[model samples]
Target: MAIAKGYAATDASKPLTPFTFERREPNADDVVIDIKFAGICHSDIHTVRNEWKNAVYPIVPGHEIAGIVSAVGSAVTRFKAGDRVGVGCFVDSCVGCAARDLDREQYMPGLVGTYNDFEADGKTRTQGGYSDSIVVKEGYVMSIPDNLPLDASAPLLCAGITLYSPLRHWNAGPGKKVAIVGMGGLGHMGVKLGAAMGADITVLSQSLSKKEDGLKLGAKEYYATSDEETFKKLAGTFDLIICTVSAEIDWNAYLGLLKVDGAFVVVGIPENAIPVHAFSLVPGRKSISGSMIGSIKETQEMLDFCGKHNIVSEIETINIQQVNEAYERVLKSDVRYRFVIDIASLAA
Candidate 1:
């Protein structure tokens, strides 16, 4: 067993604090990573506070991870010592299962999350990137491009891929009008990626405060969602709408903005269910769909796509000691975009 240092919530409603735990020695297919940075995700707050029923206690919450390869099992061939790499929301899945694809192992009956869940072995609870080190299968890890800094690249594992998958799936490209709801972590990435894909990008934000930033990030248009007139003007204007806000939204109002046969893709997981009436979709043949993080194959494709376009998340770097405070700011939407933890500060 290898001793690892991390921060963990001793129980629900408790702040994360310093903790020590053990990691299994690397198997032949595993690659040991020395974690460099971790991103603070809103879902981390929900799970730590027990807002999400499936959350397990003493959980170490983090999925956006970036690091360097420190050691590789003898059988590992994809990476070597000193390689830059990253791990996302999951670590391992059943590779032999039917649902498993070349890019993702099937985890329908049982999926091992990056944290707060048990591994296939059943005895060990999987910890996450909140720690100083991790051992993941080579197949599940991705190569971080040398052009992108590791800190900003961390959130790409989650927020970046979350938006990219839907954009690609729905074919947001040249001549398509794409509207991204919310201007925070995920939305900002949506704007950049959507624009990079040759779409006419717009930002639908609650206020005009982020309008300038949104435009700078590739949005060709910005509108305040709080304004009644804004909705009237955009009615039947968009080909695709990506909502990244976790709060309950006026679904019908947003749906009204979609053009005929358009789609509204949801990536946020709201705490409570919001009622969706059938009328919202029936009239224009509008569609509402949801997406999880991308498949491992898709994630790699996203990274390559971003790398090719020189795209990366806009982040505010915080020290490890400020992690709890960062959580508070995230709740208030006080972050400029995303918060990335500098693990070097953990040594302090």
Candidate 2:
């Protein structure tokens, strides 16, 4: 076993605190990483608080990880010591399944999440990247591009791939009018990637609060969803709408904004279910779909795409000790985008 240190929520109601743990020693295909940064995701809060009902106690919640390899197993060939790498939402899955080959490991029969889930052995709980070190199979780790800063690149592992997978699946690109709902971590990434893919980008946020930031992030238009006229104006105007907001919204109203055969892709998991009318999809042949984070292969492709396009997430770096406060700010939507914890602080 390898000694590891991280911040963990010991119980549902408590704040995350320094906790010491152990990790399995490297297997023949494992790569050991000294974590540098771990992005705090909204789902981290939900899972820690037991809002998702899948919460596992003593949870070290983090998936958006960026670090440098400190060692590699004897059979590893994809990476070596001192190489930049990252691990995302998933750490293991049924790789032999056809779903895995299609980059649909999330749908695999037994997918292992980075944290709060059990491993294949069915007893060892999988800890995540919110730690000083992690050992993952080489197939699950991705090479981070030299052009991207490890800190800012951390969120790309989760939020970045979350948006990229859907956009790529929905074929959001040139001649497409893409509307990103919300202006936070996931939405901002959607805006950037959509625009980069040559789609005309529109930000449909709660209000004009982050309008300027949205436009600066590559949105061609920004509309306040609070204004009734805003919905009227954009009705039947978008080829795709990506809803990144986790709160319950008027789903039917947003559906009304879609053009014929347009899709509304949901990336955020709201605490409460929002009712959707069949008529919403019936009219205009629209569809509402949901996407999870990408598979390992596609996540690597997303990193390569972001690197090629000079794309990286906008982030606020916080020390590991500030994680609790960061969660509060995240709930208030006070963060400009994503918050990444500098893991070196954990060692301190």
Candidate 3:
């Protein structure tokens, strides 16, 4: 076992504190990463606060991990020392399944999370990347392209893939009229990627305060939900509407924005069940769906695509000591987009 240093929440009500724990020794197919940066995801906040029903103590919550390979297990063939790589939400799953795409692994009954989840062994709990180093199996680790810097590329492991999976599945590309609801981390990526795919992009934010950033990110038009007329004007105007915020949205109202056969897809999680009137979809035969983060194969594809397009989440780098304050800022939607922890500060 190797001692790893990181910050952890001992309980839901208290602040996270520095903690040291032992990680399982590497196996033949494992790769030990010298973690350089870890992105703060809203899901990490939910898990740490025990809002998701299952709260694990001493949880080291981070999955958007980027770093360099420090050591490789004896049988490791995919990577060598000094190679850049990343680990997303999941670290492992039920070994062999009938699913051929591998991108479907997250749906497997035994999907193991990078943090607050158990490995396939069932005895060892998984710790995430808010630490100085991590040991992940070679197959589960993704390659970080040369063009994308490690820190900025960290959040792509989660936010990038979460938005990309749905866009790809819904075929948001050339000639399509796409609307991204919310201009935060996920929404901005939706605009960038949707535009790169050749779609006509629009931003439907809660307010016009971010209109400039939205347009700069590739949205051709921007509207604020605060304006009742915005909804009335955009009725049946979009082929695809991607909802990225967790706060409850008027299901029937947003559903009204979809054209005939258009899709209203949600990637964010709200605490309460949404109330939708059937009339919202009855008129246009519209459909509503939800998406989870992508599978390992799809995550790699998203990263490669981001590399090709020169895309990365707009990030504000923070040190480990600033994590609690950062969490509060995230709650207020105060970040420009995403927050990345410079892991080097842990060893300072």
Candidate 4:
């Protein structure tokens, strides 16, 4: 066993504190990673705080991980001791399942989250990457492109892939008019990526606060949803709308912005039940859908795609000690975009 140190949520309400734990020694299919940067995902907050109604005590919560490979087991062939790598939302899925075979393992019944989940053994808990080191299965590890810096690229493991998967699946390339709701972490990536894919990207934010940043990030149009006229002007305009905020807004209003046969995809998790009327979709033949983080193959593709486009999340780097404060900042929407932890602080 290898001793590991990280911040842990001991209870639902208490702050995270330094915790020591054991990481299993590398097996033949395992790769030991020196986790350098861990991105603070909103999902991490949800899990740690028991907002998701499934909290395990002493949980070390983080999934958007970027690091360097320090060692590899004998059976691992794709990674070496010095490779730059990442681990995303999930770590494992049932082998030989149809979803796994199709490289859509995110939908597999046995999908194991990188954090706050049980291993395939069902007894051993799986810890996450708000730490100095991690041991991951070779199949679950990703090769981050050399051109992308590890710190900035960390959030791509989760946030980037989360947006990329839906964009790709919905064919948000040339000739598509796409609207991204919310100008925060997930929504900003949607604009950047949808634009890169040749879509006519627009930003539908709560207010104009992030208008400048949205345009700079490739959003051709930016409108404040707070203005009634904004929704009126854009009604029946978009071919696809991706909502990335957890705020309970008028779902029907967003649906009305889509063209006939258009789709509204939700990647964000709202706290309460979203009330959607059947008329929201029946009139326009619109469809509502949801996407989790991408499969391993898809996530690798997202990393390579970001590499080619020189795209990375807009990040504010924080040390391990500031994670609790970071969480509060996140709740207030105080971050410019994503928050990445410099894991070296854990060692200090």
Candidate RMSDs in order: 1.4, 1.2, 1.0, 1.0
What tens digits encode model 3's per-residue C-alpha lDDT throughout 61-177?
999999999999999999999999999999888777515546688777778899998888888989999998899988789999999999999999999999999899999999999
lDDT of 4 by residue, 209-290 (tens): 9999999999999999999998899999999999999898989989999999999999998878888899989988999999
Cα shift from native, residue 79, model 4 (Å): 0.5
The candidates, ranked best first by lDDT, are: 4, 3, 2, 1
In candidate 2, what are the lDDT values of residues 87-153, reduced to their tens digit? Answer: 9988888867834366788667778899999887899888987899998888889999999999999
Clashes of 1: 1
Candidate 2: stretches off by over 4 Å: 98-100
Stretches of candidate 3 above 4 Å error? 98-101
Clashing pairs counted in every model: 1, 0, 0, 0
Candidate 4: stretches off by over 4 Å = 98-100
Clashing pairs in 4: none
Residue 206 of candidate 4: its Cα lDDT?
Answer: 91
Native-vs-model 3 lDDT? 0.92
Worst 10 residues of 2 by lDDT: 98-107
How close to the true structure is residue 166 of candidate 4, measured as C-alpha lDDT? Answer: 95
Predictions in order: lDDT: 0.90, 0.91, 0.92, 0.93
Q: Candidate 3, after superposition: displacement of residue 293 in Å?
A: 0.6
Error of 4 at 261 (Å): 0.7
